[model samples]
Target: MLRRVRRQVADTLRVGAMTLYYLARGQRQRGAVLAQMFEVGNRSVVFTVLTLGFLGAIITLQAGFQALRIIGDTSLVGPQSLPLLVRQLGPTLTGLMVATRVGTGIAAEVGSMVVTEQVDALRMNNAPPVDYLIKPRFVACLVMIPALTVVGIASAFVAGMFTAQAAFHTQPAVYARFDVVKLSDLAEGLSKAVAFGAVIPIIAGASGLMARGGSAGVGEATTRAVVYSSLAVIVLDFVLGGLAFLVFA
Candidate 1:
């Protein structure tokens, strides 16, 4: 059992190293980088924006009610919620959403390729399939997810401000008076995005490559990719959040 555990650990490390190498290679391929950025980031814009907007509205509404109950000042809701949105919720939720959407898609596609023997064909042709398939995805997720997180955070905060104005009848001056620690908050959010982005696609893609059987195998790989990648992102969020607190607390 111990030997099996060690073998698994070693295998995981090797896979991680290979994924990193692929990402580096993909980064140098300008066309692949741009294409993947659009594929991963641009394609998912609607979902991201809608999620951010909903989050903003809900948090603003709830906080306004809570603040009115006690302090009778609804304006504090925006100020209170904006930082929480950007600093903690924004990046983490965005990452999870991407994992569910892009990560599952990647896993199923690659798993289908594997099960259909396309990966074997590439191997027979002396082509490194990882370079063509896995690498672009890893690089795209790392680059584009962070960029999407930035837009999400901004939208959530701004929409929160708007919500405060519309729902609470608060003036823009109330939001303008809010104190946001932009640098530390932005740094923490982006850091979470980058870490999650790198980890999720690799988990999905590698699992896909290991897929076998037929349609069932592809479905299993896709499900595992979504579940594991989401879990990993959540765990990494706590780790990164703790590290940020230590550094910027």
Candidate 2:
């Protein structure tokens, strides 16, 4: 069991190193990068908007309720909810969403290529699969995940405004007016997004590259990719949050 664990860790590191090496050299298919970025960002917009909007509304309602009862100020919800969402919830949730959706998609696609021996064929043609496949994916995830997080965070505030008005009769601009989300909060969130973005594609693409045993293996690879990347996001969020607190607290 320990041997297997060690092997997995070694394999994961090898995959990351290869992908990073390719990323440093720049991409061969500029179109591929743009297509991937569109897939990662544009395709996820509705999901991000709806999920985050409702979540923001729920948070606003809860915070407003508590503030109303204790301090008789629904506007206080802005300070409690916006800062928390911007610094932690926004990036973490965004990462998890991308891991589940985009990570799984990348893994499944790559795993199909593996199961069908397309990757081997590409290599036979003297094409570097790592540069062609892994690098673009890594770049797309790193670039787009943070952008998606920003969109989601902004939408969440809009949703929170509606919820706050309904629950507490608070004005819509109360959140911004209070200056609750400092620059540090935004920085922390974006940093978390960057960490998560790196985690998702690297793990997913590596899992796909290692796929074997035909179609069943591809399915398993897809599942493992999403699971591993999601777990990585959660662990990273905890670590980054702790580091942020240590530095900023």
Candidate 3:
């Protein structure tokens, strides 16, 4: 178990180093990066919005319920939910969701390429896969995942407002007093976005690059990518969340 863990960590570091090396390349591959950005961001927006909207409703209902018991009114929901969502829920959920969607896609795509020897074709053509393939996905994931986190937070806020109004009689006017998106909170959330964004592609790409066998290998790599990326997001949240509290304190 320990040896396997160490091997995985070593693999992750090597892939992460390659990601960083290509991340600094100039605009020669801007088209690839932009294409990946759209795939990672625009294509995923609808799913994110819908998911966060419902999640916001559920959170608001629960917050309102608890606040009602303690404060005799659910008016506190507006101010309370934003801080929790923005500082914790927003980045974490966005990371995990996108890891499931985008990470698996990345893993399967690259794993298939590896298994089918398509990566070797690129090499035969004198094209480095790191530059032509991994860089775009790495850069795109870093940029777009944070943007998705912002969008998800906004959708949740809007949904929370409606739900709080309908289910708890906590007037829409309540959000007028919502002061939770403070600079400190924003710092925490954005920091998490950055960390989680970086985590997905590195781990997923590492798994894909290591694919063996054939179609069975690709499937296994994809599964490992999802599992590792999901776990990384949670573990990172725990570590980064602690540092955020200190940094933002």
Candidate 4:
């Protein structure tokens, strides 16, 4: 088990490094990157918005209810939740969504290619699969995840404001306070977004590259990609959040 884990980790790191090297050299196919951006960003916008919006509304309603019960006032609910939403909920939830949606798509696509020997054909032609397959997706994710995070944050904040206004009779001005947020908070959130984006493609692509067997292998790789990518996002959130607390506290 430990050996298997070690090998998977090694493969992931290797793929990540090669993808970064290609990206740094600007060796990616621009059209492929643009297509992936559309896939990662445009296709994901409505899902991200709807999911985060409902989550924000639910959270605000619960928080306001609790605050009203405890303190006879719900005015602070929005102010308090805003920082949490900006720094944690926005990026983390978006990362999870991407991990499930984009990660699975990447893995399935590459794994299918592997099972079909398409990757082997590329190798036969002396073409690096990492440069062609992973780099474009890596670039796209890096660009799009932060943008998605921002969209998610705005959606959630607006939803929370409306929920608070309707549920607790709180004014929009009070529910939309930004004074509690700081540069560090924004930095922390965006940092997590970028980090999650960087890992998703590399991990998913690595899983696909390691696929074996046949159709079953592709399925296994897709499942592994979703699980590993989601785990990476959660672990990164904890690590980055801790660092932010220690540094910015």
**In order, what is each prediction's RMSD in angstroms?**
2.9, 1.9, 1.7, 1.3
Taking all chains together, each candidate's TM-score versus the true structure is 0.89, 0.92, 0.94, 0.96
RMSD of 4: 1.3
In model 4, the runs with Cα more than 4 Å from the true position are 25-28
lDDT of 3 by residue, 86-157 (tens): 988988998888998899989999899999999999889866776677778888999999999999988988
Q: Return whichever of 2 and 3 wins on TM-score.
A: 3
- Regarding lDDT, does 2 or 4 come out ahead? 4
lDDT of each: 0.80, 0.84, 0.86, 0.91
Query: Candidate 1 residues 1-249, lDDT tens each?
Result: 677345434543566688777656533545876787888998888888889878877888888898899999886676677667777899998988899888898889999999999999987876576777778888789888888888887777778778888888887778754466568887888789889888877888877886789999999889878887888889999999999899998
Best-first order by lDDT:
4, 3, 2, 1
**Best candidate according to lDDT:** 4
> Can you write out model 2's per-residue Cα lDDT over 197-219, one digit (the tens) per residue?
88888888888887898889999
Q: Which window of 10 residues has the lowest lDDT sum in candidate 1?
A: 4-13
**lDDT value for model 3:** 0.86
Query: Which prediction has more favorable TM-score, 1 or 3?
Result: 3
Backbone collision tally, model 2 = 0
For every model shown, the clashing-pair count is 0, 0, 0, 0
